[model samples]
Target: MAGEPAVTPVPTDDELVVVPLRHWWRWVGGAVILVLLGLLGWALADAKIDYAAVPGFFTHDIMLRGLVNTVVLAVVAQAGAIVLGVVIALMRRSANPVARWFAAGYVWLFRGLPVLLQILLWFNLALVFEDISFFGIWEEKTNVLVTAFVAALLGLGLNESAYMAEIVRAGLNSVDHGQVEAAKAIGMTPATALRRVVLPQAMRVIIPPTGNNFINMLKGTSMASVIGFLELIHAANNIASRNLQIMETLLAAAAWYMVVVSVASVGQHYLERYYGKGVAR
Candidate 1:
């Protein structure tokens, strides 16, 4: 106030101050990454591959047939896996030691085995069992299992059941124990309680991961190619080999896979949102 230059306002704790900060190194790293990505894209574009073959893939009857087969295989295999998975999950959660052990052994064996190896094993199951008889009246040769569709379904479905069992168990575990007890107190049978009370809640936990698994199963169906199942990749392989446009055919197949995956992703998002309705946590 006296002899001091007019006092300037000092920033108080309540006043906001803007401080500009720069991380030059982070910017440099980002630039470098962008440059590398650009180069990679350019290289792919200029690569010595028959890009012309890719567009024709949409019109090719073989490709369309393979796509249909892939879709069918995915649906059938996933359906079987879901049923088997639920059963195994129930067994795993059972009070009986025998049932638990059986479920554990199944999960261990299937989860431990590589899916490719499992496919091969199922394909050659005829060597182990000469015939697969359903009943005295209904019988079939084990060789029947060697077919591409049968081999792929058995391998993928059985293998997926192991993963699904774990997933379902996790979902079941998410349910509150009190709910089960309450259901029992109300005189509902265990089966009725699970179906009516616990499962609905558990679905919130189950739907998202299960949707992801479905997508994975969709892609896994491509492996049926090894056994002459003319699924998408197998069909592409045949075309590529014949035309000597390996890269283009593969890219085409990859494009179709991406399209299917995108569609599945959209479906999963909606399903997750629906099931996640009441349970936002």
Candidate 2:
């Protein structure tokens, strides 16, 4: 075998000529979308809208007051919701049956009802109870105590708490049980373990949805107008009623909402990035 000459290896010019895939349909779809957008723009431009009124009402004192009210209500309600949610989340995970059942019922009742209906119910709570009494020492008529702002706060905060509870529960559940066990092994109390080991990590899961919920809360404040709480929409309605420039006033309100939502979105992005450190996006 050694005496046989090795046959010379022959090389062939066989190489793959990679061709990029052509998505002609994507270009066609894009063109169709552009055309539709152009048509929409043309229609809006041709409409009988008082462009001047939009800017005029944007800086109006009434609108400004409503904007402030909307912001305050959203911030306060969301803060309260977060606190209540954390409590409910913990309750749902408690060893005690009463706590768990109560938490479950709370979530079921609030989450099942529409937020608008809750707002209405809070506003009209006098029908259910004539007055709220504190050990007969202090008594106030339900109608008097539950003013428009108070009703809105109670409604939004309570309703949002149900949703926030679920969000929190999910975040807490996402954490590995081993981590909690490890914390317990290290002489950490349950509270300390939750605080130090669990929540900080859970935040990565919690923040995105919570931020979205906050933004939705801002928009949800508009529903407060139904009870005459004078939020942005209510203010716009008032001005439009007198001036007969409904479209313009509403558009101005829409612009303010867009501005606020845009700012909140930017903040959410940074917050997510902060919490998402060392995690693959």
Candidates' TM-scores? 0.90, 0.92
lDDT of 2: 0.95
Model 2 C-alpha RMSD to native = 3.4
Candidate 1 lDDT over 67-160, as tens digits, reads 8898898889888988999999999999999999999999999999988899988988988999887767788888864687899999999999
Score residue 13 of candidate 1 by CA lDDT.
80
Extract clashing residue pairs from model 1: none
Model 1, C-alpha of 68: deviation from truth (Å): 1.2
List of clashing residue pairs for candidate 2: none
Model 2, range 56-106, lDDT digits (tens) per residue? 999889999999999999999999999999999999999999999999999
In candidate 2, stretches whose alpha carbon ends up further than 4 angstroms from where it belongs are: 1-20
